[model samples]
Target: MVLRNIMIGIIIIVLVGGIICWTLFSKELREGKNLPLTGVDFKRLADGTYTGTYEGGRFKWRANEVQVTVSSGKVARIALLKSTEGRPSEFTNELYDKVIRSQSLQVDTISGATITSKAYLKAVEDALLKAQK
Candidate 1:
């Protein structure tokens, strides 16, 4: 009976410790939804290719980088330079296309990937900022 009680106590301690660690480690990710994103004016951007990065929030969980090409004062193309996660997913192209088509970072974020979408857009915005005149 004493052995069983000790085992149960150990298990409870492990579970509680895991929960505490998870909460602390994931705090930044949890707060990512509140990340603010702003769009730059295309008319004000000089014609050039600019590279920008989102340092992946405070902890760099989703850090990303992109190259933005502006020609004739409009976004011509955007290429992913680096991603925290290898390989762009299904939503990547759609998000980039939307930015190019609309020329803005105010597009609707991809469902179930809202934080990721914001991170990419933030990187694009960073690139655009460099081109701002």
Candidate 2:
């Protein structure tokens, strides 16, 4: 009986430790400390239609889509087809302007919604690549 109680205590301790570690790691990742951006080649894209996707990783809901259209080697329009609520939706509109005006996905990530910004940028990049192909 004593052994069983010790084992239970150990398990509880381990579980709690794991939860704490995950929480800390997730926060670090969301803050862009643990997560590193692997920049994609956006210049390969030509004038055409593209499909993009963005997943917020652990920060927000996974799965998002963007439709991109390029004209004269520049972004003509960017449409956020789908995204999670909160920051994602708010940033989507802002992204459209930034991308179109800048003609690139290298714009700054949305303030306060960093993860969502990353996801949106990824999705838009994917769409632009699709259009190129």
Candidate 3:
């Protein structure tokens, strides 16, 4: 009887772990669909400031808002107004620099900070989308 109980407990634990893993995995997969930012033409955007927000992940790993500045058809600056994540704010700031330097969202994400990187990129993409035309 005791062995049976132990087996049942082990099974319950495995099932619970599997459910948790599946939940996180599916969420990441859904978010991945939105990762690609393409066909953004800087030249087509008007020179001005724009704002955007990407509330991704489980609300705890989100970039609430980002401000982008465009001048003379170039991305001049990017600022993160709000974000919630495990990494330091400086890591997020690196994303802004990458966007400004590359003038595109195709730049690589920061190593060891994939979620924050994606959130920051998404926020920038949102801002650029607003700048279109």
**What is residue 65's positional error in candidate 3, in angstroms?**
1.4
TM-score of every model versus the real structure: 0.60, 0.50, 0.57
TM-score of model 2 (CA atoms): 0.50
How far in Å is the alpha carbon of 107 misplaced in model 3? 16
lDDT of 3: 0.77
Candidates ranked by TM-score, best first?
A: 1, 3, 2
In the range 1-133, model 1's lDDT, one tens digit per residue, is 9999999999999999999889877787677876777777565889899999988766777789999999988888988888985655667778889878877554444455446777888977997998893
Candidate 2's residue-wise lDDT over 1-133, tens digit each? 9999999999999999999999977775675544564474556568898888867566555457889887777778888777674556567778678756664556545455456677888988998999896
How many clashing pairs does model 3 include? 0
Clashing pairs in 2: 49-131, 50-127, 50-131, 51-127, 52-127, 53-123
